[model samples]
Target: MNAIQFGEPVSGKTVSARVSPAGGLDILSRNEVARLRDASGSGLHQLLRRCALAVLTSGNLSDEPGTIFEQYPDFDIQVLQEDRGIKIELKNAPEQAFVDGRIIRGINELLVAVVRDIVYISTQLESGGFDLDETVGITHAVFEILRNSRILRPQVDPNLVVCWGGHSISRDEYEYTKRVGYQLGLRGMDICTGCGPGAMKGPMKGATIAHAKQRRKGNRYIGITEPGIIAAESPNPIVNNLVIMPDIEKRLEAFVRLGHGIIVFPGGVGTAEEILYMLGLLLLPQNQEIPFPLIFTGPQQSAAYFEQIDRFLRLCLGDEVSRHYRIIIDDPAAVAHAMVSGIDKVRNHRLDNKDAFFFNWALDIPLPFQQPFRPTHEAMASLALHRDRPRHELAADLRRAFSGIVAGNVKEDGVRAIAEHGPFVIDGEADVMRALDDLLKAFVAQHRMKLPGGTAYEPCYVVRT
Candidate 1:
């Protein structure tokens, strides 16, 4: 948290800043540095700019990705190869990220992480450093990205918990997440999430207080995100460590590989996508024996929400799939106790199998799930959502269906695609389609599709029954 030396503040909503590396990475090659500032269409500049802008304007409530960029149209960022090391050059950046003419330390650290990850993935992966075609290659790439970001630590037990839910949720559900997080923190567990507001922010918020009370050190509030969704759900400042994966698939893989257990709160399509992804992984015959704790919990008011989710899951994946997760309502202490208990089993399993404490190397992530899914109109229509296929395969398709809705709703490309092509048409089994339609309707009725203050949401997709 040293005093920052940034350019003179401008009079408007933007300011000029130069951020030195606070953590993760400090040095970079000249070519890599150049690409970071390249303004060409294929260069990393635009990707860097949009993602960096999202981080600068942390705590934004808009689910629309383009809104923030429109506000700071002239905002830009660059990386400089300095004699000492690397320095980030910011022009017309959000002034809110600064405090008394200096960039906030936590934000600066996260900014460095964003820059570090972007540069690493762009330079190394693009140069064929990691083969991403196969499942093993993809898993290795995720591991390397995490290791490079310094997110993986040795000699640590299985205590990191991943919490997933909508960026926009009701106040009661959000409070419930915090209560669960406080109890988890008191038991010395770390927190990971998508790094946005609502459910994502709540757990970290609660954990901080609990960590302080317990005099915890090196408390990890990790936020894993991607470029496409950064604007829609900006990283909250409470996130001490942030890793921007190459894509949503990689981001989701990072969650399962890094977290010892998972707790899901009520959310819209994005949350449903996560639940499906987890179940799909566990349902695999190879992964059936893996002890991955999954729990869905919320306030009492959201009981029907989980019930609907449970029903949809059963209709799609069959009753046996219920073994993969537990649905707990209105009991924060009980949820925490369950997570701790599950993680204990995880610790034992990892020990008996000789797996690393930081990474779940034994868990199997299939090629279908590892590959990035482009939620195009055609892709949406081509999904195999019928029950004739294997349960895991069907789960994967359902996950993709929700993923498309998420993209169309928030991600810049998905939003633009929907605008140009109209709502995506999801063709699937009649029963499954009925279940999905009903569940999505519940999300909309509960105002979970978008932030409460925004305009009423028009669904970006239509399921063909």
Candidate 2:
């Protein structure tokens, strides 16, 4: 691994280097090599470039995917296979990803992960290895992705807690997430998050300290992400296991399947989408007996945030939906204790059912929830957000509405669609629409939905009542 001292004219902080992958993959077939090197419209080079750049500039808070590419227009990476292994060649890469003259090991592993996942998914799709047309096929695809990443631990118990929340959460909320994480870690639970900043990062950060104090070894801090959202929310430094799913739906499914329990911190539409997705599944009659522990928590200052979420959830799904989760504000220890107890139940249930400790095979995720939701204007307007339908179905559409707004707010395609087509119009029942509007407005008011830099938060969709 060698580095050139001179920086590109476009950026002074950038450098060119040849570095070997720390982990993930060592070699690729002749066909895979061509697919990666091909920069044409049909190739994977552009996607590789995007994800690799995000890895090179890890921990950047900005969610603007366009701005990053614009900032480093000359940056490029190539996968070169040698007789022994492969070497990653970089041009105009972010220097922060390097230490002195060498690429950071973690960043290198993440870059390898980018190459590995992109190649795996693309290869599977082309070879018809994934059957996305049906429900079981989708779940199988998710399992295969995780298995290839090698993050699953069959020998381990049910102790991974999936944490969800807004990446741009407030300082108080961020600290609260850490507190919750610390308590969970002290009790021997590992963490998995979206692998970005804010709430996604806090739990992992807190757990590191607790794990050290407990002298725990082989602790897993896994970060699950999708390509579209990767630039907006780069994998945080704490993530030792990074797995990139093909899309958001697969990523969400990965979370539910991999973790025994989940804790939701205060967040924006993205968090809401996660909540709705989980509730929609739990509300299913088939999932009624499943004992997945879900807790919503924040500091005292953020109690109102949960309250608003609770209100909106009840109005949208029904009061009975509350049975699946519990809210514990200003109590990190209590939240952690609850999660521990809940996971014990999960362990016993899994043991009785002869299920795998690493994956939840019993969770019945329908095809609708597993399918990729393109937040196009027409798609957004087509979502049925009213409560006249079944609660799970409504939850699914409501999740889509929030997901579209999320896409518009962060994902490159969603952002471009919004810019070209204007904000999406979300027409639903009067009361439900009003409730959603109020909840979103509150999020904006509380600064949960922070925009790039100082740009004020703007609505990406109009909730028509």
What is the TM-score of each predicted model, taking all chains together? Answer: 0.96, 0.97
Which lDDT values do the candidates have, in the order given? Answer: 0.88, 0.88
- Cα displacement (angstroms), candidate 1, residue 266, comes to 0.7
- CA-RMSD of model 1: 4.5
lDDT of prediction 1: 0.88
lDDT tens digits, residues 306-379, model 2? Answer: 88899998988889989899999999999999999999999999999999999999999999999898888889
lDDT of 1 by residue, 1-465 (tens): 011111222233988988787877768888888888788987888888888888888866566778887789899888888788888888998888888878989888888888889889987777899998898889999999999989999998889999999777777777888999999999999999999888898899889889999999999999999998887888888999899999999999999999999999988889999999999999999998889999999989889899999999999999999999999999999999999999999999999999998999999888999999999999999999899999999999999999999999888899889999999999878998988889888888887787766476889988776
Task: Give the distance in Å from residue 191's predicted Cα in candidate 2 to where it truly belongs.
Answer: 0.6
Error of 1 at 384 (Å): 1.1
Candidate 2, pairs of clashing residues: none
Per model, how many backbone clashes are there? 0, 0
Model 2 segments beyond 4 Å from truth?
Answer: 1-12
